[model samples]
Target: MVTRPASPSSRARLASARGTPRPDRQMAILLAAEKLFAQHGYHGVSIRQIAEEAQVPLALVGYYYGPKSELFHAIFEHWQGTIQERLALLQQVLAGPPTEAFLRQVVEAFVRPVLVQRASTEGEYYAQLVGRELARQTPETHRVLTEFFDPLAHSFIDAIHAARPGHDRARAAWAYQFALGALLHHITDHRAPTLSRGRNQVCAPEAAALLVDFITAGIAAVMPLPSSLSPSPTASPSPRRRAPSPSTTSRRQA
Candidate 1:
């Protein structure tokens, strides 16, 4: 049987509740989970530890979230509002049609929220948690990536592809991947300032603009695939490996 979508009224109500002061029990569990998951990985964390950190009974953890994977997914589901804002911003930029500045616009759309999150108090834990999980690349993390991250990425990739039709699909894909990689790496690396001798920092307000400029240039640098590699009208014949000369073959066989 088909299921109806959530009504706008119900959605807004839920959003309001989530944004406001939630019950201590649930928020405690989620915060605990985020902390533990950030410190230890998904595999390293356990339901018991989460319960301990939350200061709630172990049963409550199970009651609130059926399984560890579900709980992990819930952490992301809790943050859907931020993701929605990013998508909305991207959609607005896309509506303006392609231009020379399209790549910069797309990069800004992707990078701004990320940098914003990196700078905010609540967002610090979230950025760390997300970066750690992504780096871990465990089976559960893979599930999260597919369920939440890939679809969002695909949207931006499509926008990038549309903006630069001259580039091949492979290059467009690479550009998107590179841009995301840079963003995530910057967020995850807390030692950036120390490592750079205090010359560079990743979480500054202007960081997003700098990243946008760099990423847009990187995306633009993808050279088109060579003409020889392009598909031929008639099926291109595969090059045959030359058979060894009879004398050389006989000598080798001997």
Candidate 2:
């Protein structure tokens, strides 16, 4: 028997099997840039490094994203979808009564996506990148981070006020900040198991739920009603004792 030449379809299949399908070049560059930018501050990473990490030509990074700033912006845009999910859930929550339970749901909607992303390999890098951006807090990166997070934060703050009509709005804002601090802490340093010496641990699924609980309770704790808003106790008149006092005086004199 003689060996036969492979058909076109078989050849394509062989090529595909021999190598993994590559992601879109632009997207790969952004992803690689994000991981590097997160590991090193934006100022510390170069287009060349991103290209090398992405396994693409140095010129391709510039061709796709133009410059380092634009490449960084692309990472922000990539996460826009996640922000949209948060906003949609927030709108849905706002559509209903702003009860405590609903507020917790809103908190879950805001934070769960971020924590869930950490559970995946790619997402882990993204989360680290976000945390790093926060730490660096240069004027440009600060503006970029704020542009994405501030609007979402305001919506939640409004919902929190609606949930407890009498709660202090200023305190509620502080609570929002505190909640963000907690999330950033988790993202940058997830060493709970080490801290507890392995007695306590938080898995990804549990992390979201626990965070919702912690933040919701924290908000509730901080946002107490002002005295003006609190219900006043009813005042009662003192009982009349004049007659009894006079009788007792007379009896003592006799």
Candidate 3:
């Protein structure tokens, strides 16, 4: 019996099957999973599909990363540095008591990383994944958000509050959400170019400056809730009126 050399195509399949070993293996799975999860909702995709898409053995997916949820999480962990970058920028902006300028910087810090990522080929899938998860509001998605983002939100929200002292906390909080909503919508919104009749790209470079400007003014514009309206739970309580003295009441009666 004679052993024969494998064909190039056979070797290629073997290479994909072995899956680049270590870091590359994990990355291939991560990228495949990210694209699939983004295109189809989390529930809509499966572990086997990811393995096939990545062209790695099914068990290796688990061996390298674990279950589907963990793979989903790995995607975020892969990009954790971006969150840290934003946090660092945010802290710098927040170092001085927040000014109008700080508000713009804060908005830039919050929007730029996500926007730039969304604009890039490498990050496009991850951006889409984010948009879908937010829409689904699934338990897994909430878990990820809580683990990775809640702290960031609190920091930025506090920064916004610090930036504008006269405004109630509720206003500051809503303004944060509103700014977030604008960025999320802008990144995920597909109709912008069509809506603009080819005048805009979804991730146009100019849009970053414009987005920061728009969100800054919007944050600045968050008015305190009306006095007649009940205060938000976080709002400082209104003082009660002092009771009239009994002597004064008697004098009035007399």
**Which one is best on TM-score?**
3
Candidates' TM-scores? 0.75, 0.74, 0.78
lDDT of 1 at 183: 84
Clashing pairs in 3: none
Per-candidate Cα lDDT values, in order, are 0.69, 0.66, 0.71
Best lDDT among the predictions, by candidate number: 3
Worst 10 residues of 2 by lDDT: 245-254
- Please give, for residues 1-254, the per-residue lDDT of candidate 2 as tens digits: 11224556755655643354344766778889989988887899988899899887776566556668877877877778877887787776656542336657768877877776667667777777777775565766766656776666666666666655565656656777888888777766767789879865644465667888998888767865444443345633222111011011111100
Q: Give the local distance difference test score of model 1.
A: 0.69
Which pairs of residues have clashing backbones in candidate 1? none
Number of clashes found in candidate 1: 0
lDDT of 2 at 99: 37
- Root-mean-square deviation (CA) per prediction: 14.5, 19.1, 14.5
Question: 152 in model 3: Cα distance from truth in Å?
Answer: 0.7
Q: Give the residue spans of candidate 2 off by over 4 A.
A: 1-23, 97-100, 199-203, 225-254
